[model samples]
Every structure is written in structure tokens, then in C-alpha cells.
Target: MRKTLLSIASLLLVAGNINATNIGYSKDEISRNNVFRLGSTEKQGQAMRLSHAKLQALKGKTIDFAEFVLGSKNVTDKKMHVFLTKQLDGTPIAEGTVEVKKALSKIKWTLDKPYTITGDEDCLYVGYTTEVATTYKVLMSDGSYDIEGCNYGYKDGAWVDTYGMNKGSALIFVNAENVGDYTDAIIAQSNFEGYYKAGDNCNFSACFVNAGTTDITSFDAIVEVGGNKTTQHFADLSIKPKEGYSFDLKDVDTSSEGEQSLSVTIANVNGAGKETDTSDNSVSANLFLYPKTMERSLLLEAFTGQDCGNCPGGHLNIEAAIKKTEKNVIEVAHHVGYKPDMFTMSEDPTYIFFYPNMSSTFAPAAMVNRNTYANVSTTPIVSATDVNSLLSTIYYADTKEPYVSLYLKTTLDESTRELNVKLYVLPHKTVPHNSSIFNVYLVQDGIEARQANGGDNYIHNRTFRGTVTGNAWGYLVKDIKAGQLLSWEKTITIPESIHSSYYADETKNNVEAVLKNMSVVAYIGEFDQNDNNKHTIYNCCEARLGESHKQTGFVKPTDVNSAEAEQSVSIFVSNGKVHAGGAYDRLQVYNLAGAQVENADLTKGVYIVKVTADGKQTTKKVLVK
Candidate 1:
């Protein structure tokens, strides 16, 4: 998904003349990663409409040719029909047909007679239609980087906007000519940290495209923030037509606090003052600055499965990286991508949707902090072999401040096999309502499982058990104010089935859920209801059951401790006996099956100790060793 939406005011204007130039929707090179089609035997087609702003420069120009790219096809009878229309589903102003030949090959159809643009029409539609018997995928692209007025799929005789549906734009373009000379530079994309701290030096970057016929030799970039402007110049460069150059501006001042709007503009193209098209020369973004910085604990959500032969390498690489950095890194291994195993939870499939495209959906892949780190892949998904990139991202992300801080506490009931968790969210700045979520995951360590290459009885740690928040995307909260403390409590029942292996006739039992080996991981992240790829974690923390954990961010609210002390009931194990402290009305013990044990001979194992004080109840897991 695009980080920022491009409006008509941000679209580049192109000149059309006798010197024909290819015009299309995609700004990047087309690399086939996935394919799309309506259905077998059904006419599959894709179309693009030139925006009014883009057509202004070509008002009187003519479209001489229509070109398109297609994926591999088996049927020889399928013919691609290309058409140009003033309106969708309208009579074609110009049409041509070509035989489908090779894969990833560009097929062109020279119009019998050129169709001139009147500039009165709202937009010009260019599309191709074809029918296949069994091979339905007729079009292909890298991924869904939707742009308005582009990426329309024809289905059931109606054009549907496939935005956020993974239906990438069809590789179709037109050769328009007959206008005049023009110079234009547009910011195709921009990047910067999501959040920053006051007084920190921020960095910014953008991809500038030469949208005109003239080559760009010199240019200037200006960044404005907080009423201050900084200009950077570049010279002795040659950027040809339809080409892009990326530039980075480092150490921009970020002294202003609160959410600040930053704008970047391209100026003096070829050192000839402003270009003819200025609408696309500038882009703006919002960045938040916090008064203080918090120490961040990164979260690594890994995708793997028992049947994956290369999965063990991913585990070793992650473990080695953690040991080398010694950073507080919390990991959750999801049993997905290759095949489902006993550890595969109901929500595990949903996590796979976090992949930017179908190509990156594979085992031995992981998302660090759910962020697209600088110099890394454009998407959050990274291969396990890129350990250095992973480390660099971890270090870079750790230096940045989070918008909110997370604190977690967990209590386990061995008898009822329930885990209770309390999550506290402290905001450093005001957060918009329904824009973020809090995710809680139950992960266990020391599980013996079969590994494709490492042999049976492989110890799998940080195995995802389930979601404590019920929803895989987490719980959404209301508007939050700075210094406000918000908390959520949830009770999760642990199933006994987790202790057994359910992988391909492998009968392994007694893989106990050791109390000391289990932990609850929680984090706060920004959520986009429309696009999962935009979700990024803000902050995270982990807490083990029946133990104390500490994290640095905000001071723990004293009122919470006071309230707990007033109704506190301490349950502990010592000298092979379960001890209960503080005043209590009743006390009892039970086994893992929720069965009460009355004065039974105890052994070296685990038990659930429950106590009721002043009508309030609490449970704790006790281990006798």
C-alpha cells in the first residue's frame, strides 16, 4: 500500500507531440510476481483511465498505438483486443487485435487511424480483453500499488476498482504525441521515520522522476518544517525521460514538538526556474515529535512450519542475532506458510496476510517490528538469510521513540488452565481514536517437535499458542490523551492439546507447558482497516507468568500498586509446600484438569494454588522441584 495518497494536484502533466513517448500508470518497472484473471472461459480484461489533469497537456494530441504485456498462456486461439474509448463500456474510438504469443512480451497494435484527444472528455480509457479456457491468468504485475484512475478490472460486464484487492494494474500504455517541449519533475515516493523525539536529527528521502522529454541536468530540493526552509542543490547529472533518481537529506532539525507537517518540493529543474508542471513538484507528510524517548523492545514475528526444511536455519539465525545484540527482543514463531502443525492457531492464517504480496509468502520469513526499515526491502517481510539487514534494522528502530509504551502483567491458573493478563498503555502523545490496536499473544518455549532436517525432538521455543485478545489484529481503543493510562484485562484458557504433537502421525506427548517457559507478549501498533501492510508496531513488552518483569518507559502508576495491595493475596511455593499469605476466606488446590485435590500426597511437579481474600480471588502456578 502507498504510504500517502496521491491526488490530482500531485499528478505529473506530460507533453504529447510527434515525438512519441510511452505513458502508463506504473512509475516503476513491471516485474511479474503474481497474476490475476476473472475466471476460466470468462472474458478477462483490465483498463486504465488517464486522469483529467494528466490529459490537459495532451488535449489536441493523438494516440497512435496501444501496447500491453501478458503472462504465459497455453491456448493459441486466444486473441487480445485493445481499444480506446471516451467512456467505459462505450463504443471504441479506435480498436485493434493481436495474437497472444509469448510470456512477459509486449504486444503492440498500431491504430488503423489515430484518435485525436478533444480535451473535453473527462478521461481516456485504454484496456485489453481476452478469453482463456483453463489458463485464466492473462495479466501480471509486481503488486498492488493502486493509483486512482488506474487499475480497473472488468468483471461481470462492469469495471470494478481493485484497490486493496491485490489486482495490480495491467501493463498497458499508449503512445501519445503532438504537443510541445516541456520540463517536469515529480516526487514519485517519499520516506521518513514514523515518529521522532524532540531535538533529534531526522532524515528524509524521495524518488524524483523526470516526467518530461528534456533530460534533467540540475535540480534543487527544498524541505520546509516549522516555518524553516532548507534547500539542497544537485548538479552535473543527466536523468533521461521516464527515469528516476533517488536523493536523501540527512540531519534535518526536529526541535518542534507535537505533530508537525513537513513538505518537500522539487525546484529549478535543469536550473531553469520552475518546470511547466508544478502540481507534482511538491509532497507533504505528517511526523510526530515526542518530548521524551523510550527504550524500545523489538518484536519479531516469524513464519515457519515443521515440514519446512530450511526453517531450522531461520531459527538459528534469529537466535544468533538476538545473542549478538543482547537486545530485549520478543519472538513469536507462527506455524504457517509451509503447512499447519499442532502450534498453528486459528489466527495464524491471518498473519500471513501481512505479507506485502503473494511472492513473499514463504517459510523462513519474518517481520521485525512490522516496519519497512531504511535500506531494507520496501516491505516489512525479510528473508532469514539477511541477518545483517535484520540487525541493522533492529538497531535503527531501537534508536527511534514510540508513540505509546506498553506494560504487561500475567497470572496463570494451573487448575483451570487459564491465564489472566493485564495490559497497560501509556501514551507519550495524543493518539487518535480507532487508529491503533493492542495485540496480545500467548507463546510457549521448550516444545519438542519434529524438524525436517534437524531430526525429531527438536526444541521449538516461542511457539505461538493463541491470541489472548481474541482477535488476531488486537483490541482497538478510543482516543487517548498524553499522560493518560489505559488498561485492558483478559482471561485466556490454555488447552491441554497444546502439549501433544499433531504433525503427520507423529505421536509425541508430555510436552508440558512449563510455567517458567511461557510468556505473554503484547504490543501497541498503528492499524489501517483498509490495508494490513500499513500496520506498524509502536511499542512492545513481554511478561512471564508467576514472575516479575520490568521495562523502562513511563513510571508505573502508583495507584495500581495501592489498589493491589489493598486486596492483595500472595500465593507461593516453598519447601515442597504451597503457601498463602495475607487474609483469605478460603484456599484450595487443583490439578491441570480443574479437579480439586483435597489433602493429597504431593509430588515433584506443578499445581494451581488459588486463594480468596475479602471476596476477591487470585490464582498462581506453583512448581515443586
Candidate 2:
């Protein structure tokens, strides 16, 4: 298993610049909206979804005032309505109006009669409405914060979820006086060992928020896993109100096999005294321990094109970063963004959809493992100019353990030019069918291509050839269980020639296939048809033609009889009809190009026949006479 470079003791230190308020604007969001305004005549408003735990903290407490920070530019006198409602568009239970007159002004509204929170509602909406036809600006957070589904917008007479819109949240704060002097500790976020192998140490870490009015001097963190409890006491903490402290517990004994529940809770605030609120003091997560950990190879899909001048620099930076890390990283250069080149495949443009703007400016961008870096933008796409951030993200991705192991076996026919591929999937944890998909990509290296900025004889490496998986996203697999082995077999015919223009002055040219420069990349990731942000690569592996690739440290469970049963099944072609020796629930036949072929119409020289029985599958190659 891979571990982070941070020391165990250093991991317990508190994070800096903790936001005291429940939800506030971020500095990034503020800078982006230096002179922002709602330049429309239509009525518009911003609202934030307050969680039940945050609302419960103010239960029975008097809401003294509400404040809003307005932008500095084009500030004009306008009437603002502050309201607290159960729903975004529902009638407000508490309403107050305040007038704003200056720029960068903090508009405050003191309720004539203080409103006491009932604390019974699941969530509450706090926001304001104002008319800003031309010269009105409201400060908004960049919406890159961790809170999801907490920000909403009102436009066209309706409330909409603005989380995916990349629009900032309104900078609104609600104040309430606590009923009594009490110390409260809230577990704002926690990180625990998600995938562990047998005999490995389990680590737990969390960031605590001092939600209470009083300062937190010391606290006890109790971690429970697999019926075992371990408590770590921290003293002399000095965690003040609205501040945060983080702690880590390492080497805990949670290495038992199978699924386990892990929970971390803060108790004994300031040495054996109960906090005012315990609702947000605890967090829990489920983890699965496998018998062994598999090696992971990250996929870096670089979006580049020959027309992009900066793409050459992007390639240099990426190559340097990969060389520095010395990690097994598979690279696929997608010819998209600036302009489609000869190497561009049909599905290459779809990768550009991951950009927030979906613009051609996405060229010279790179995504490592298709994961969203919380510290970076919400989307996985990052500009290649930011080499430091890209390298950091790559290093961060290397620490995660793969949930499944992939094994690829390939064979190539010299005369027929057919590449037979067999993929075996061994899942260490349960994965949902809807969210996961398997993809196979064919990429070639050392292709002589013309570069706009570099040279005429510039060689492109790892250029995308075609998608062997039929579907652009991938072939969606069924629900997978722990220790279950699934297999798929397909044959892809290598094209004899490809039409592409090498130079700006030349027309389309025929490029011959280079067998030695070709390789197959297979990966599994989360899939979403509409949102590319949801597509996250879990694990990927690559194998060159005429070679076999197998993952080490994959110890299949002995109880899994399906692996043997798959071998027992026999498939052969007799009199141009496919026959199976064992009973099968379903049978299918496909030609070399992955298209399904009917049994009756099977006059092919070679075909792939798949037999499935009792939830197990076996595939074999048959020759039809």
C-alpha cells in the first residue's frame, strides 16, 4: 500500500485560515468578482442552504442581526429584503428590509423582534432579494468551496441549483447569540483509510471546528473500527471560536478482511466536559479491506493539438513531471481543443466537454485520473501552464489505493491484422453498475506529425488512434461484488492505413500502420452521460501488442469458484454453428471488430463467442468453416 509523505505527528496540526461562519465567501471567489454586478432588470436573489446541524446550533437562540457584504464598484442606494424560509421560494418565516447606499458596505438588519429558530426543519434558506438593473453588485464566493447543493439562485421566477453552474454564492451571514457559555467541537471534515489490505495499518484523521462560543483548550478524539475503540487525547490546543484543528491517528488495528464501519467522534471537550452540541461532533465512513493491494497506473489524458503554440511547452512540462515522479503513468494525447488534427479520433472532442466553458481554449490542458482537485477548480481540467499544480495533483493521485485489479491478455495475428484482447476484472469492493464503465483505447507512439510552433518533423507520442470499446464512454458493467471475477473478450482489427495531412500546405496523406508503435490502454472509471465532471478514472493499465500484462499482488480468493467454472465451459464451432459444452444462461457471437454477429449468419473465418452461465462468463475463439 502507498502512504503519504506527511509524518503521523505533523498530520495532527490545525489548518490555517479557517472560516468561522457556517458558509462564507472564499478569497478566490471574491477576487473573481472584483467589479461584478447583477446586470439585469429581472428580479434576482441568492440563497444558501443551511444544514440541520448548523440550524440546531441556533435553536432557541435569538437571531440578533443579518449582514451582507456588497461589492465595492457601482454601489448605489437600493432596498434589500432579507428573509428566512423553509424553502427557496416559500413564504419567509422571518423577513426584514434594509437599505444600502455605499460601495463595499456591510448592510445590517436588526429584527424588531428577535426570531428564535425552531430547530425542527431539515434545512433553512437564508438569502436576500434586490433590484440591480445596472449599477448594483453583490459579493459572492467562487462556489469552489466543498459545500455541495448548499447554494441556490433565483431567476425567471424559479429557484435553481447553482452548484453545477459555477456561479458564486452570495456573501450573507446570519448572527445569533448563544443561550449559554459552552464549548462545542464539530468534526467539519474527516479523512480515513478507505481501502486497506490485510495486515495493514488503518489511519484516521479529521478537522475539527470550534462552533461553540468559548475557546477549546483540549479534546478527546475517539475512533471506532471493527468493534475496537481507540482514544487519543490532545491538550494545549488553543482552538478559538470559528477556528479549526486537525488531528491524525495512525497504526490502528482495522486490517481485518471484508467490509468494516469506521467512525471518529470528538468527546470530553476541555478535559471531560460535554459540549453544548453533539450533533456535528461525529463522522462515519465505510471501508473495505482486501486480501491484497493492486498496483495502480494513473491515466493522464493530455488535450493538445498541432495548431496550439503552447502545446509543445505542455508536452515538455508533462514529460519532465513524469520523469521526476518515476511513477507508472500512461499518457494519451487527445488531438482536440485548438483544432482537430489527423490523429484526432471521433470521440476526442467529447473530452473537451469536461471544461467548464466547453471552449477551444481547453487545448494545452491536462487531466490526471479525471479527479477534481478540491484545492484547484471543481473540474478535473487544468491548464498546462500550471505545472506545479498539475504535478502536485499527480502526486496526490498516486496515494490512493485501487478498488479493483485489472489483467489484460492480448494476442496479435500477423496476417489477419486482428488484435485479440481479453480483460479480467477482479473487484476488491462492491461497485454500482450505473456509476462504473470499462473502456479500451488504442494509442500509437512515434508518429511523424507537423507542429505549428516546433518543427515539421515533430514526432507525436501516445497519439490516440481509436476507441475499441464501441461506446465512447465505455461498456457499462453490471453490479460487481467483492471477490467476484468478470471477464470480457473482444477483437479489434488494426487499420491498414490512416488518412491524415502532415503539413499545412499538404492535403490528406495515407499513413501506414506501425505495429511496434501501437499499444492498448484499458481503464475503468465512473461515468455520467451529461456531466463530464462526474467521470473519474479509478484505475488504468496498458499493454503493447503481442504482449501480455498481468498485475501483481492480486490474490484471488479461494472461495471464488467462478474462475474455475469459467475454464470448465467449452465453446467450439461445428458445421458453421457455435456449440457450448456446458449449460449457459446466454450466448453471443461477435466478429473481430466487436460488432455482434448472429449465429445463423456466421460465415466468418474467425469469431469470438461468449458464454455466460450462473453469473460467470467464458469467451473463446472459434473458426467457422
Candidate 3:
């Protein structure tokens, strides 16, 4: 029960008298005649934790506005500033008493770390003195700090301030323009008919009408079908605008199946690369994206390696086509054998270039998303029902108009285990005139290996460690832009053994795996330099993720049963005994980490129950007892 963070620090001053370093203060507080040095001096001893002041006594008057709660117990970059010493009590004579914007809304900072003070500068520093007790400490260059709060409020005029609260930023847009068939006149639409489950409910409305003159302060619209493209722009855009906008598709895997790629980006925090004026007033939309459909989404690509012994039955037929598509298949394993696949050479080169065009020379083969085999001389070779009947004949073919449209921009440089990728290749239409190569794939999410079959273990997901065109498959968009759109950039290196096991497993590693869940999966098909899949398109797209929700809230189990006491004595014996009418009158027992073992305010009985989890517990008595 410790979650309290409220901080907003901005202190700027010091364009002159530089060169000052004494470290632990008191040299007359660094020879003050007017001093303010808080900007990189190796984060001066970062340590801040002070919040003990709340002695309420109102009605008889006694309210205190003296609140201070700043943080940092280590890993310094110091930020919590203050400085405005110009005599109000010690009569300093010259100016500078402290207006720092009237103590910037009454200084009130607090954050025991985890909102992580961002870049370009300004994390914390607020100095405002009239000299009563001018403290100091803010020296950062990765030395982390901020512990200086002086006071002198001259009747709320200004002194020692640095307040908080400004969590406002959102801009998202997903589906725009596809508004025709309201299928029976609106109520909800994003077009989905019959078989789509997981809570089915939908809506879509858009009308900014035009922002041609452009200068919107807020905007949002996102209709992501599933995952990747930075997990559909950081998880289905709950809106975030500040030089921020997204339209992801690189190496498509919107939780895969067939035909689903919609992108409409429009972000504005002062619109970053400009040009968004949809003419004065255009931005309108009613929204909702809970369209859950299932019946198909199968495509399993596992090239396999780690000295393939039939790559564990092609990793058990891509884990039985993801439990026979209950998880709706779009599985990519791609290790590419003859060694080096400790998870895609750790980063990529998609198996030294799709391993002899995936000849696998026979050892654990696959390709559901790239359509292969059929005859390629089978062996202990490629068998998961022959990759599930080549995934039921490419899920019944018939999905076009998206030859290949992938674009991505990744950035991560843990002091250079550097992960810099910027790849784009959009061509929903138009290709011919020697369409070269451009295939990018690098998928790594949660790697846990150890399977010599029998020792089992295998926790691999979206795992295909690396491949940046050095695998003979592709990477040559040389002078070609028919449906125009091509880009390239690469810089990977997060393999110092996955960065020393994620900095030695930073307590189960997560900063969303250090920046929005690692991803890089690009595909443009038919490379070995053109065999013409015509108008150019062979998309099966991979790199997927979804299903990681944790809510162990209510918990209440100690082995209770009758099947949970005959379903709580048949809901008070089918409600007749308790007689109220219907709709559950009483009977409660919840657990699955949602506590509340029992709550009975009944009139009719029929009891006996018990349940427990993770340890094991059970009990069951009878009718209302």
C-alpha cells in the first residue's frame, strides 16, 4: 500500500560563473555571493526521503501547507532543485528573493521512484532562498539526486517551490475512413459478422471534420486488430500525444490470421514532422474496438536449430499449432540449425539466411507463413502433420491487396548493446520491374529453453532471435518504389547474453523488457532475388504477443467444495427456499485470488464449501449446512 508520486520540477539558472566543484558543500556553501550549480557534477550524493507532516486540527483551525515528499535512495541523476538567495531576513541588500514563478504553484513533490524522470534535462531542482536554511544537492550525470528545499514564503509571494501534477498527454488514431455499411444502421460498427469472440462489442465514430489549419490540443483514434507494431502502438492507444503518433505494420503479426492491417496516424504535441492540417476542423470519431473473432489465424514458421534433433518435432508442431489454434495460430520459431540458434544467433540473420533456402538439410523444418515443403524431401524432417497440412492449405488462400507493408522504428542503447532499427517497405499495390529483396525478422520475447525432449522446459514465445537480411532471403530494395515507400536502418546488439541476463535479471526483468516489449519482424517475400509472386505479395507476417494480464486481487480459498458445496447449495437451492423472485438472492464464495471465502446473508440454506489454490485445500458438506 505504498504508491504516492507527485512531482513537477523545473529550475533553470546558471549561464555564467561555471567551473565550481567542491563536492560535499560547506565551503561557505561553495563561496556564495550568488550561487546556483545544479546540473551535472556527478549527481551529488542522491538521497531524499522525508514526509512526516500531517497534524490536522481543523474546525478549530490548524492547517499546514508545508508539504515535502521527494525521493531517490540511489542510482542518482539528482533532480529536486532550489535557489533564490537575496535576503529577506539576513538583509542581503541586492535583488533575488524568489519568484520562481510564485514558487511554481506552491511546491509539492513526491515520488519514491517510478515515473522515471525523462530526458533532455529537468528532473528536479528548486531553490528559493531568503536565507533561513539554504540547502543544496543536485549533481547528475548518472549520479542521481535532488534533496534541497529552502523556505521563505513572504505571504505567498514566492520562495523555494517546485510543485507537481501535469499528467496530460494523448493522441491516437487507428481506423479512419471505411464508413459505409452500418449493417442495419449504426449501434456499433468496425465490421465483424458471426464468429468473433472474447466479449464482442464494437463502435466507431470519427469527426475532427478537418484540422487543416492544424493546432489541435488533443486527439485520439486507434483500431488495432492485435499485436506488434509496438504492440499496436503501446497497447491499443489509450491516447498519448506529444510529438507522438503511430501507424505500425513492420513484419505484420497483428495477432495474425489473414487480411488485417489498418493504420491511421495523427498525433499532435505540436505535430512533430509537421503537415497534418486536414483543413481547419477535422477530427471526429466515436470509438470502441472489442471485436473478437476466431475460426482462424493460422501460420506457423519454425526454422529450428540448437543442433536440431528433428528440432523437437518442429517444437512439437509449433506447440500443436498453438493448441490447435485455440490460441489462434501465427507461431514463428525460426532458429535455423547447424548450430547458432541459441535463439536466433541471439539477435538475427534469420538463420544464416533462411538456412539453404530452408533445405534444413533435414533436421526440424517448418514454414507456415512462407509456404514450403510439399515435397522438399521429407525426413525426421518437417512433421507436425506436415506442418498441419501446410496449415490447412494456407488457411484457404484468398486474401490480397497487401502485398507487403511493414514499417518499424526501434531505439534502445544500453550504452550500446545498441538496438536501432528503422525499416519501412510499403507497397499494398505495385511491384514489378525487378523487385529485389527486403526481408527483416528479429523476434525475441521471453526465452527460457532446455529441451532435449524429456527434460522438456521450453518457454519460447515469438522466438526467432535474429536475421537482418544476411540469410540469403532478402534485403535489397535498391532503387525501387512503385507504390512508393521504402526505408532502411539497422543496429542490433542486445546480446552480451541478452545483456548479462537483463542486467542480472533486474528482479525478473521488465521495463516492458526495457522499452515497449522488444520486437522487429519484417517480411516482403520472394527473395533470392525475384521469382515474381507478382504485383509482389506473399505476406504471412509474424511476431505476436498477447495474454499477460495479472489480477490476483480477491483471493479466498481453503479447500471448499460440494463442487463448491453443490454450487453454493444450488444458489440457495435454486432460489425457491430463500424465495425472493430470482437473480441470486444470496450465496458467495470467491477465490482465484479474489478472496471472500464466504458471505452468507441467507434466509434459506444448503451449505458446505471450501477451496484453495497453489497449495491445495478442499472440503464439502451438504444442503444449507
Query: lDDT of each model, Cα atoms only?
Result: 0.70, 0.69, 0.33
- Model 3 poorest 10 in a row by lDDT: 180-189
lDDT, candidate 2, 297-335, per-residue tens: 899989998888989999998898887888888999988
Per lDDT, what order, best first? Answer: 1, 2, 3
Clash pairs detected, candidate 1: 16-178, 16-179, 17-177, 17-178, 17-179, 18-178
For residues 447-499, write the lDDT of model 1, one tens digit per residue: 78788987998989899877788888888876777767776766566766553
Q: How well is each residue in 1-625 modelled by candidate 3, as lDDT tens digits?
A: 1111111111111112232111110111111112232322332211111111100100112111111212221212222332211233343212222222221022332222212112222112222222212244211111111112211122233222211111110000111111111100001011222222234332222211111212223333333344323221222222211111222223323233333444333333233333322222222221222113212233456655555565666676657655654533455565544454344344333333333444434446554444333354222124443656544534432222224444344555466445555544544334434545666655566565554552445655666544655453555554444345555544445544432121344343221232234465655544442221222324434332221111111012232212222222112222222211113334344434545444444334444444333334443333432
Highest lDDT: which candidate? Answer: 1
The ten-residue window of minimal lDDT in model 2 covers: 5-14
Error of 3 at 565 (Å): 72
Root-mean-square deviation of each candidate, in angstroms?
9.7, 8.2, 31.8
* Candidate that would win on TM-score: 2
TM-score of 2: 0.71
The better-scoring model by TM-score among 1 and 3 is 1
